[model samples]
Target: MTAYAVGQLRNVQMNDGIVDYLHGIDATLAPFGGRFIIHGGTRETLEGSPADDLIVIAFPSKAAARAWYVSPAYQVLVPLRLQGAEGDIYLMEGVGSEHRATDILDVG
Candidate 1:
């Protein structure tokens, strides 16, 4: 199933390390078929206040997402991101195309 790596980042420090991380991330993602679906940009707030930046990267599958996150190429950049941003990054499996809202009722 398709999966995503989502990040809710705040207190970002735009330093050289962060810039280097940005420069190197794409090369690492290419091999694993990961692409950014959302990167902190303009948004219309309809509810509670949200100051943190939201980032979402979609991958072919959970395994692919996990692999890309821990791969040597990407791991080297992890520290830079951690040093630059305070946030949480997590992987989540996606629902199939035929999924329905009522599907939650089936969850045990």
Candidate 2:
């Protein structure tokens, strides 16, 4: 199943550290079959508070997503991201093709 790594960046510091992080991230992602589905694109907030920026990356599976996040190469760039931006990042599993609303609803 596919998995996603989503990040909601706030209070970004746009500096050399962030530039290095962007340049090196692709190489780290390639080995884990991760691809950027969305990277700092325009967004409209339909609801809730707005975020400064959003990033979404897709991976082959949940494990792959987790593995990539903790990989040695990615770890090297973590500090740069942290120093460049304040945000929340997380992994979420994707639903299968046959998924239905009832699959997640608990209406007993």
Candidate 3:
């Protein structure tokens, strides 16, 4: 199944810290079959204010995603992500195919 990780980032305050985290995060996601599907782009506001950044990543399976996230290497980056940005993150699984609610959460 395909899993996705989605994030909405606002008030990003730590520049250098996030940069470093991303460097390590990119490398960590590779072996787990993770890829960025959305790398944050512009959008027209329709209602409430939206965050400046939105990101989505796909993974082969929910287990693969979970494994990557809990791995020692990536776990260290969690705090950086939290302290650097104010946002919400969620995992959803695709349906009918490899993508299901279970699959979406599996992405790292």
The candidate maximizing TM-score is 1
lDDT of 1 by residue, 1-108 (tens): 999999899999999888999999999999999999998679899999997899999999999999999999999999999888998899999999999999989967
Q: Rate the local accuracy (lDDT) of all candidates.
A: 0.93, 0.92, 0.80
Ranking by lDDT: 1, 2, 3
Worst 10 residues of 3 by lDDT: 94-103
Candidate 2 lDDT for residue 83? 81
The most accurate candidate by lDDT is 1
Clash number for candidate 2: 0
State the lDDT of candidate 3 residue by residue for 19-82, as single tens digits: 7888778888888898999985668789997656888889988888877778898889888887
lDDT of 2 by residue, 50-76 (tens): 856889999999999999999999999
Better-scoring candidate (lDDT), 1 or 3: 1
Cα TM-score per model: 0.94, 0.90, 0.76
Candidate 1, residue 93: how far the Cα is off, in Å: 0.7
Clashes of each: 0, 0, 14
